[model samples]
Target: MEVVALVSGGKDSCMSMLEWGNDTMGTDELDSFMFQTVGHTVLQSYAQCMGLPLFRHTIRGKALNQDLHYAKTQEDEVESLYVLLKEVKKRFPNVQGVASGAILSDYQRFRVENVCERLGLVSLAYLWQRDQKELLQEMTEVPIDAVLIKVAALGLDPYKHLGKSITALRPLLFRLSDEYGCHPCGEGGEYETLTLDCPLFRYKIVLDETEVVIHSDDQFAQVGYFQIAKHHLEPKADYDASLVSGGEGIVYDVWKELPDELPQCTEAEVAVDAASTTHGELQAAEPLDISLSHGAQAKCRGGEHRRVAAGPTLCRHKG
Candidate 1:
């Protein structure tokens, strides 16, 4: 069934496309629909990286009111999406499904599903009802290199976390999830992410320059977004064909084997492990290989090495 993926250039939207493309009936050759909301302009680069045809329509009414409440208050925004989907239908002619990345937002899910119902398209929310923490870990396990472009939560430091990779923010996310009840996946407007590279991309995006905008700052909460000044898509010479050629990609598996209680280690142990590696040899080799365990080995790509531990633990180092 041909589908139209709703994307916002955020982690959930991008990851939802990756999840949908894993299904037997889905493929990389799918149409994408995006609402031209506040951050919608940056999605063009994201769509380019994925090599998908995008259909965009700017929301005619106020994009986001100062205060947003549930119910029909945002119905006008939904209508904008509905109009875009109709255009996608006109172009594709065979689009039967509308894919969404709603993890826990019933407000978003209900509205999108309502629109699809009127249009006779199935609403496919593959990421629905999944654990947010596990979902985030799964995202990092794959090649989804997302960076925080906006933050609006209590615990996150805009200065520290802005433009930091999602992989690097896992610990902070977990802490916020445990202490402050913040959604680990940022499903509740806690943060927003921009995917730089993923298995679905034909080219990788490199941000050339960015300006940080701080809308509000106080002790309780900090809100901000990164304005991309310039960026370009770099070609991926070793692009994995199997990712889009009907075979299972790196993100195909759902981490069901994740341990209930992951093993804990101290900072001293991590420092010791880091110090043990031969830095001189690593710098000299072109394609360095480092064995992490009996079955796991780290491979150097583009002078970088990412070591994956046994159970959803990642340790990255630059050579």
Candidate 2:
């Protein structure tokens, strides 16, 4: 099915797209309650890199209702998604689904699924409720080439850490997770990443200019973000072309810098007690037909007999 990708210029979202493994008809760049919009200035380049059409919209609604199950309202931000997706469906009639990068946030997952239901589209989230540390390691190994664009956690130096690549910062991130109780995958908003390149890209995104804007200067934890002033896509040769075939022709001699012993990643998901909201009692998401088998990837087959219900069931795993 031709699904529309929901990109937010972040690592998890990009990885989710990679996990999609389907033909993405296009991409929608949104600034909403669920999106990390700090690097939205360079988001347009993502379409160029992925060779897809770009659809963009600024959310015009506020978080008037903060609940687990969302009801349709004109004044809420989820409605803005509804509006944008409605336009997408109107323009691309064959588009059957919407893809998102929801990890642990039940609030975001339910809201997006709510909009998909209203629009009669499937909601695809390949990275829901995965262990944070394992997810982080997989992201780094995926070689997403993501960088820190925002840092708002303790023990992270805003001035010193901003704009550093995730591959280079993995050690520090894990250490901080052990000592400072930081979320290794940035699930708790300790930091945010902006993906620069991925295997799916036809070109590489390069940051030409940027400026760090500090939101807070507290001694312990500093809140900061970067404004991407200018960026351009570097043309990359297609590996299927005459110059290369069957593999990436570019070679790297990595034995010199490689460590002989593989490091064991024991980082687990940080547990946070979620209390009932005073706003209202929450409703649990409808149980999905998909399996949550450990160390196994559950795929949704395209058989006519296999139909994923269009509600708050968000997990669509890899092969």
Candidate 3:
């Protein structure tokens, strides 16, 4: 069915689009619609990359006020969104359903349902209350570029959110949920994200202008950044330098700096403990050390070492 998906550039929205994939060619169902509330440029970049037909609504007045105030309930939040969806429904006369990225939010679901009822549009929320840890792990396995656009919760260095890959952040996210009260996927407004490249997008987004926001106080050390501009995606034989890291067609030799053997007690293990970190932060900054009778040995996974003890203190691994 042709549908208008309310995409937030988050995992749930992106994954909802992927659900349209069909077993056979030419049988794919669902036409996607993306709307950007505040980040129009980011959405535009995404549309150009994914080649999707998008409808943009400029958010202002009451809606903008509510967002600025960080309104907690959906009543205030959806007042503006409802108006936007109404306009979108008219554009797609054949739309049978409206898609959303809502997960674990009754307010979000109820609001979407209310809007759909008014427009005779079906509400599709594929992800709601799924195991966040599993959901996040699945995201890492998927082909997508999830980057942090906003981080307001405790323990999240706004700096870490910017330009960080979702895969690299998964372990950290798990730790945050276990150790701190922060939501694992930022489902509770701990942070926000934008997917730069994905299967749904035809082109990849490349950031051209970005500025970091620094909030300095005696209590916190953090940075936040936003994309001001990005490359205009157009057909070209060669990839743009600003878009591709390490440049297009450039080969990376991974073996260039790899070590043959790691000094060790032998095998290495990852506990995968969410409790070790909070808000995507590893609790302990110190590395695990292997203490010996004569001395102590601290060796990183890649073989970097510091000898805390004097005697024959072999590392956790030999490199």
Choose the strongest candidate by TM-score.
2
Model 2 — which ten-residue stretch has the worst lDDT? 287-296
What clash pairs does model 2 have? none
Please write out the lDDT profile of model 1 over residues 106-214, one tens digit for every residue: 5456666767777887776767767988889999997688898777787877788889999999989999999999889876567777788888776788889887777
Instruction: Report the Cα lDDT for residue 23, model 3.
Output: 10
Q: TM-score for each prediction?
A: 0.68, 0.77, 0.61
Ranking, lDDT, top scorer first: 2, 1, 3
lDDT of 2 by residue, 58-120 (tens): 454455677666888656656656766776677667777777887877777788788888889
Q: What is residue 273's positional error in candidate 2, in angstroms? A: 21
The local distance difference test score of model 2 is 0.62
Q: Residue 17 in model 3: shift from native, Å?
A: 1.4
Write the residue-wise lDDT of candidate 3 on 18-45 in tens digits. 5433110000111101122212345434
Superior by lDDT: candidate 1 or candidate 3: 1
State the C-alpha lDDT per candidate: 0.53, 0.62, 0.45
Candidate with top lDDT is: 2
* Pairs of residues at least 3 apart in sequence or in different chains that clash in candidate 1: none
